[model samples]
Target: MTQISIGVPVFNGAKSLDAVLECLRVQTFTDFEVIISDNGSTDGSKEIAAGFAARDSRFRLVEHAHNIGAKNNFLSLVEEANCDLFIWRADDDLCDPDFLAILKRHFDSNPELALAAPRVKFVHDDGSPNYEEDFQILSDKIRPLRIGDALMGASSSWIFGLWKRDALRHALEITLPTYPYVWGWDPLTLLPPLLDERVETDANALLIKKSISTARYRWQVPAREMWEMRRAFSRTCFIAFRQRDWTLAERVIVGVYVFRFANLRVYRFWKTVRAQMREWLGLKRRQRRSVEG
Candidate 1:
């Protein structure tokens, strides 16, 4: 059995890490390794990973000297994984026991699929899922292409999709900067469009449970503050699109563009530009030093 490398990136995710690990243990597909890349978590999350590593030969952990930011942390783990098959699981999410098995079967059956994901079901921290939930944006299932239509519409966890190691690396080459950090990978999902890979939506769900119970993002401290922003964005869009107001709508939309389509589809142009500028400045400084030498 080939071991699939599951890349999990975490930062100060103590409260929710153990449950995910527990879920990982029960996975029906046993041939897999869990690689946790630590992003300088202050909490004892590393200890949690260490416990798992001690118990399971398939579990391994990597620590960053300092926090490499969220996005780079993800790339660092993905790039470091030894397996050709990979899936990204966040510290804040839970998986069904059959996740690896279902996904792997699709990988073996459809040799052409660059990306494959099983049905994704979301649950609260208490493991409650609502069938009536409208998950247009954050659900992980994307509209399939002509050939990939079978995997479309609530069929799979394509939202938290899986990719061939090489395919993901190539897509990252196209969409990711050499520099890494968090807060940017969401928008980069657009790279899948560029790769033209089909998503397998027909596979059974790889269960996805929300870690914190709330939609808070920072998950650092005073976490609810993150949700307040979400509530504000949702209200603003409601007032703008549904209420037919325009005065502050555009400004609000632009300001929180990322949160527009539920935070996954908005343009990261400005943020990406700012990141590039930092890289440029750093490179220029090094070049000047070399010239002076």
Candidate 2:
């Protein structure tokens, strides 16, 4: 069996798919398999992936007849993995050739590590530097963080990290059903890993995440959906609270985290309301001026 599995889920991502596949092809670590899942794309994404598979014996392509939603596609990729380690790679993202090598060394040496992630370097479409004005966060070494701190800092960056296949599978099986396909659902999908005490991160920029338009998670993907997701996430947290492993102090910290999350939601709702009100008032002013004229 392969030591690592890289699953790429694509839908009309032909434009950047080739570059991503090529990045994988040149990885310093070769004991890996690439599984590309095409979500019924008409934009030659399937052909691009197929071509890569043809050239690279390690690359495999899976095509779906219907367009399954993004969440399902992601979960399916994990389910298809057979290796001891797995990572969900975006078709539009680029990874450093040494990404797998660095992760492999750390994971193989550290039996207690549940998830291993590298520092993320954001780049433009043309491969130019992003965040030029801001100093990049650099890490000279890989280290583990407390579970609560990791969960608070969790985002899409950590979600793509290398995971122990069995741990990831169990996490997904427990968390996916609670995930609502709404705005900012990525962090929710990461709850299980974030709660694990053995998460580690390296400061090396082993992953280059391209800031594509569709890659950004918007907060406006239907209010009902957002509400449903928050509800589901809260329920899942309570379920987590019942775990025998967590201490009373840890459970209290989790409760505090949930409270903070609720406050964040309220803040977002007010911000949305204020923006809508401004738009509505602007429209009224325009209509009145038009009527007078």
Candidate 3:
């Protein structure tokens, strides 16, 4: 078995799949298998993945006849992975050649480490630099502080980090019940490992992410959907909080953190609502002026 399994869950990712695959092919660390899970894409994604698998012994393609939801596609990769170390690679993200090697070294040096992620550089679809983010979480031994730090500012990029397979599976089991919705899934899945105090980050190892204007998309979602997302986020935090064995003080601390996190989401939801209301009013005014003219 390979030392690591890199799972790529893709759907209509033809535009960037080739480049992503090339990045993996040239990685300085060579003992890893690439499992490409294609979600019935008609946009030539299947052929691109198949071609890579045909040429590289380390690459394998798994086909789904029908389009499974994105969440299911991600879970399928985890189920298919064979290595003790696993990571989910987005079809559009690029990693430094030494990314795997650096993270693997961290795990090797610290057997207790459950997850290791590098800092992330965000780029536009056209390959222009956007910004860089440090994968920040309090590395404190105190579980509440770690959970609070993660809830406040953990980068979603951590979801792509190299993880001990068992830690990842355990995290997913705790977080998946509330994960059917798209928003806020990453932070919830990341909390369990952070609470375990075994997650680490290296700024030198880099992941270049292709930004897709996700912030704008989130704002555009209907207000009702945003409320549903907020509910899911709250439920996830509650479930995660209950799953742990905590002292009374730890429970109270976690409760405070969860309160803050929920309030933050609620604030964002209201902001989105106001933005949409203004947009709708502007559109109405434009229509009235056009009619009068």
Judged by TM-score, which candidate is best?
A: 3
Candidate 3, residues 1-293: lDDT per residue as tens digits? 68999999998999999999999999999999999999888899999999999999999999999888777888889989999999999889998999999999989999988899889999987889999998565555566777777666667788899999998998888878766764566667877776666788888889999886634234555656666777777777678778778899988987887767765744266676775686667543122111000
lDDT of each: 0.57, 0.70, 0.81
lDDT of 1: 0.57
Per-residue alpha-carbon lDDT of candidate 1 for residues 1-293, written as tens digits (9 for 90 to 100): 55688888888888989988888778898877889888888889999999999998888889887877666777777778888888888887776677777778877898876666555556666767744222222334332222122212222234356678887776566544421322334434433432243445443555575633332232231223333434443333233233322346443443343233423332223443444565556533222111000
Clashing residue pairs in all predictions, respectively, total 12, 0, 0
Order the candidate numbers by lDDT, best to worst.
3, 2, 1
Question: Which of the numbered candidates is closest to the native, going by highest lDDT?
Answer: 3
Give candidate 3 misplaced runs (Cα > 4 Å).
137-143, 214-217, 263-269, 272-293
lDDT of 2 by residue, 36-73 (tens): 99988899999999999998899999999988877677
TM-score, every prediction: 0.63, 0.81, 0.86
Which of candidates 1 and 3 reaches a greater lDDT?
3
Angstrom error of the Cα, residue 25, model 1: value is 2.0
Give the clashing pairs for model 2.
Answer: none
Off by over 4 Å in 2: 132-145, 212-220, 261-293
Ranked candidates, highest TM-score first: 3, 2, 1
